[model samples]
Target chain A: MHTAGVTLQQVAQQAGVSLATASRVLHGSGSRTVGEELRRRVEAAAQELRYVSNAPAQALARATSDVVGLIVHDVADPYFGAIAAGAMRAAREQRLMVMIAATFREPGLELEYLRSLRAQRARAVILAGSGTADADATARLAEEIAGFEADGGRVVCVGERGPDLDTVVMANRGGGGLAARGLWDLGHRRIGVVSGPAELLTVRHRLDGARRALRSLGAPLAPDAVTVGDFTREGGRVAAVRLLRARPDLTAVLVLNDVMAAGALAGLRDDLGLAVPDRVSVVGFDDVPFAADLRPALSTVRLPLEAAGEAAVRLLLEPSGDEPRRVALAAELVLRDSTATTVG
Target chain B: MHTAGVTLQQVAQQAGVSLATASRVLHGSGSRTVGEELRRRVEAAAQELRYVSNAPAQALARATSDVVGLIVHDVADPYFGAIAAGAMRAAREQRLMVMIAATFREPGLELEYLRSLRAQRARAVILAGSGTADADATARLAEEIAGFEADGGRVVCVGERGPDLDTVVMANRGGGGLAARGLWDLGHRRIGVVSGPAELLTVRHRLDGARRALRSLGAPLAPDAVTVGDFTREGGRVAAVRLLRARPDLTAVLVLNDVMAAGALAGLRDDLGLAVPDRVSVVGFDDVPFAADLRPALSTVRLPLEAAGEAAVRLLLEPSGDEPRRVALAAELVLRDSTATTVG
Candidate 1:
């Protein structure tokens, strides 16, 4: 007898079936292949014996649970929402339940969630967000990932890279450079940037790339023209207002992400009374779905956010050896009516 | 010896402490009140014995899991996204992990997800979406929820009412009536309706209420005026195009939700070259965050979606008797630039 006081072999004998057939019936699998009569008989035998399968025990024996743990910075943001949809699609295909936790961009909360996921013995843990520049937090996260892997758990990151872990890296730098070059080529010399939080590696990398492009075009970016916010729509609006106030001569503005860009556009038009592409051109990154529907349509860089999410899950499910796998997605600039030649 | 080969008494004896102290330290609770020296001694004793706490076994003993399960129609939609954020906040306060599953508006998938959540032994399950009109699907869901409750699980529905289950009901009918009357007061005699999937109870209720209000104003709604889609932006766009093509003489349009309203506005301006509130007035339900940011500013009925989500969680966590609890939230109309006096 097992811990539940009834063994599979005994149930099979009582049901006049083989152990494999009884196991299949009890596990709720291979129902189509087995005869209905036999299946009913096995189920009845198990019921008569008061058999109850302990799921956590079974999971412990297999060293894995059916749950896939996903950590995101915030689910309210459209960018994360799109990525989560793609990840959930992949998870559904694999018949896995997803346990999601939002950190709200707090590095400490991210680490805490990792520990909780590890304790739950999740099949895989996917960290979906930009990496924090804090050294202590990074070290703590690396340690947690290493410990999880040592216990035979898989870890994959989307849009973030960690030490010796698989990652789906979005082309934030290249996308930023493309946006800068697109605006500069349009005779936009005096441009402002609506940047997200300065501590995020994503914000830093994109800003650095944009600055590099500006220098290459003989238009050095003014240090005072860069305004920072929380990477939200409201943040974009606030930053845009600050930028306009600091430099009214600016002919164009580049937002870090499409959401913030939407805010910047609204601020420019509603608050500043500026006509898009006529008085002040606007460029954004990450061509979200609504970008094309916005008034005048937003010109932005397209990042394969959904595809990257899928790739992260795929990497987590695939077998791995010593070295970690890496997948880098490209970002392209999509021109729309939001950008045009600077008015003389 | 217990299942793990060591007992709390053994650790207590090894640490030269009381059994309660050892139990508290081993469970990792009350550490703040317990002395540091005593806590370290108990931990060392546990380490020496290589003790591991079986969380699921303990949960089974207590007849509860630490995880909360949430089911949504679609997470990518901003409406659901906002609700999820509110639900997450409530769950966070209880230190519970949330397992989220999206059914994509599939009734079969909804039932299947509930079963999966039950198998995982979730503490509580929150179903957040409009109930389907399919009798068979609704009956199956009710049965599943009943079985879960019988097994000591809690079930709560948000914006959906199941047979004798706790529900957080949004005032869809009243909200729809308010929008219709608001338009009627503005002298909009001929108005088109962009409704969601006809199978959703929310759609039927809202449409019925709007038609009732229209009749009261002596402007009976034509059966052909209602166009249905999947409650999505693209669906709204298609429905708007069809509405315009079929009834070009209409003076106003009311969408079932803000997302579809945004789509209808885009279709009107981009495809039909119609100016909002000038050529034809527009109104939407569910004033999502971006509704006010849209060009011309959408006039919408505001539903406390996030608050409803929070209420659902609260209902699920509270103890209930044979009688189930119900919370109904009020919806109000917010006037904006999208609606105005009909042009001559």
Candidate 2:
């Protein structure tokens, strides 16, 4: 109003295109895919004019929240934080917002919140909660997400998408296999396991990989060697205790998460009085912010949590030609001071 | 309707009163404060017939957005999750809703979001982010909040209100002093400190308290004893290294946060190769979920984040009358396995 004079219509006139065409090119409208030539022209014109679009009107016209629902089991978990960062970046790319819903590991509350989410007219829903105690509970959650889709809502479930739902998941089994191979490479035979909730699909996949690795070494998993926890620090402490009690001769422990791994470390040092790496080695999943900050620099599986979030939002908002997206992000092993070679 | 038929006006008529009086009496509108005879007649009539009032008309007459604003620094921080839970509970009690505005630790973004927050016709704004990096910034934020109040919106800033704010804060300084005194009583000397952002009032207050304790001990803070960080795990590690380098002869380190404390432990062990408790001891603030789960469990000053959120809401919704309401939550030091006596 004061100095710089420019608008989308002006840009459209300069670009020899309609206002809608200009908007499609400028706004990167998710409703339709823009061709390369028009997009480049619109971008150049908008840049020349320094055109700025009002988000509110565009959002109102969409009659949608411009918010993607990111449902996770626990907001406090550092693992989920990575996923959230990814989703936020992707959502921001489309000028969409990300709304987080933490169910606190309760399936019933999650179901109740899903109803409320429906009322918000959310652009899409990304279901990612996995650490549940029962398979039927997750199956029911999947049913609800399926119903949400049936009602013409968009959804992208991670890890375990039901048959009727569209999803973008990681190669969890492969990630687990990688972890197992890393453990095997460390010459860890009598290894103890600290697992996440039994109901979670990732736990099953990771467990399968662990079993496969053990079988490859011609070593059977000792009875009661694997202990399951709720994927919390307290759970990790309790599970570590159980594992150590059952397999005192174990030289290494693999925990499902960094938080629980931190817990297991405390329990081993304080309760069991074991020297890290010298007496026993500890490996954890989910390379959280504090993983490197830990004394032993938790040698764990690093999953692209943030990328998953971003990809989930993109997959939900922009529907590409009918191939159901099964985008599996990469995972890598970060070696640290936690694991020690078995000493004679 | 085959129900107990007893007119409330009958009781009023028998008592020689009008319908309005009968209605008031039967509803027990002023039963406790009004005349005893009127109250008795109202109670008797209400017992005879359960005549419900016209709630629909009252509801029709009322118009409100039934929404509040939750302004937070960053959703990435786990501490905010508990606070959110508390505020949500209070919102449910008040029959209103909340929308979270994530500031991402920027004052300009916070200001921009506040404008949108105001336009949403929010009944109140809950301020949960005070980065403490800029007093002037917070003051400006307070002024903006005051402006919002002038425009008929209520504001409640969490963690302590300044002269221009209505704050529900905690005894952060007192907690810090207590932590310092505990270390002193345990006979630990040559302590290193990890402080929060210098600009934050809460961080400054804690720093002042620690200084006060050191002053009481008739000792001066070593030039290299204290390091400031941004309150992240990475920040903690950076600060811890400085503290250790400055005071290699030091035995104890007090960090401002648990995440930082975890980082401090990593630096102490990985960088300095010091055995915890025997060669070094560490304490942190904020007993977050995983605080106690860490190896050599974090000894921290616990600030009830959730309770403060609930208290803040309660303060904002209710009137304080002649008294200026400033709710101060108490912070307590949780002793755990992390700290130990400095030994040669």
CAPRI rating of model 1: acceptable
* lDDT per residue as tens, model 2, B158-244: 875564467887777888787888787777878778987887777777877877888788765675788898777778888888878
Task: Identify the leading candidate in terms of DockQ.
Answer: 1
Error of 1 at A106 (Å): 1.9
A1-344 per-residue lDDT for model 2 (tens digits): 11122457899988888898898886664888777888788888887764545333343344444546777776556777667667766765675655566666668867755644544445677888563547687677766665555444687877665545566666666666677778778888888789988777778777777777777778767758899987788788889978897788888888887888888887787788887877888988878776775656688888777778777887887653355567777778887888877753
TM-score, structure 1 vs. true: 0.91
What range of 10 consecutive residues in model 2 chain B has the weakest lDDT sum? B55-64
Restricting to chain A, the TM-score for each candidate equals 0.88, 0.79
**Model 1 regions more than 4 Å off:** A1-21, A28-40, A43-54, B1-23, B28-38, B43-54
Model 1 CA lDDT for position B94: 85
DockQ of each: 0.37, 0.07
Q: Which digits, one per residue and each the tens of the lDDT, describe model 1 over residues B1-344? A: 01223456888899999987887887744544668999899999988864445455545454566888999987778888888988888888888889999998888999889878876778889998889888888888887787677666788988756647788988898998999999988988999899998888888888888989999888889988888876888888888878988999988989999899989998888788888989899999999877877777899999998898789888877886678788999999999999999744
Candidate 1 residue A240 Cα shift, in angstroms, is 0.8
What overall lDDT, based on C-alpha atoms, would model 1 receive against the true structure?
0.83
